[model samples]
Target: MARRERTRHLIELGGLVQKAGLVELADDDRATLYGAMLDCAARVQADDAGTVLALWKRRGKRAFDAEETAEEEQR
Candidate 1:
């Protein structure tokens, strides 16, 4: 059960990557996608990581909220 849950979690993360257009932007190249993700990780490891992470968190929340609003309007 735990393994299944972990699989689902990873799949959802992959879905976010696809949703963000990285898959298409990278021409479906796994290496490019992984490299981009590693770049993001490196940025978050910087001295001002907290500020960078907060900005990203806010942007993600706004995107999620916007998506939800659009879906609700469609319904």
Candidate 2:
């Protein structure tokens, strides 16, 4: 996974997210999607520990938020 490939993957994910309709997503949902995209990008950009760490941090927050929301809804 080279840098160029990683960038391309990110761009594609972004396109998918847009196509899915950003307006339909709650802020937390959008954040979750963003985190997923970043994680994918990091995987494609292998060996870049800094990038991986950053994405993980961001994604983790979003994922946690989403989970919390889901739990609240169930309660």
Per-residue lDDT over 3-72 for candidate 2, one digit per residue giving the tens place of the 0 to 100 score: 9999999898776566446535735486777676687777867877787778868976887688789999
Per-residue error for 50 in candidate 2, Å, reads: 1.8
TM-score of each: 0.95, 0.35
Deviation from native of the Cα of residue 69 in model 2, angstroms: 0.4
The lDDT per prediction is: 0.94, 0.73
In candidate 2, what residue range of length 10 has the lowest lDDT sum?
19-28
Q: Where in model 2 is the C-alpha error above 4 Å?
A: 1-46
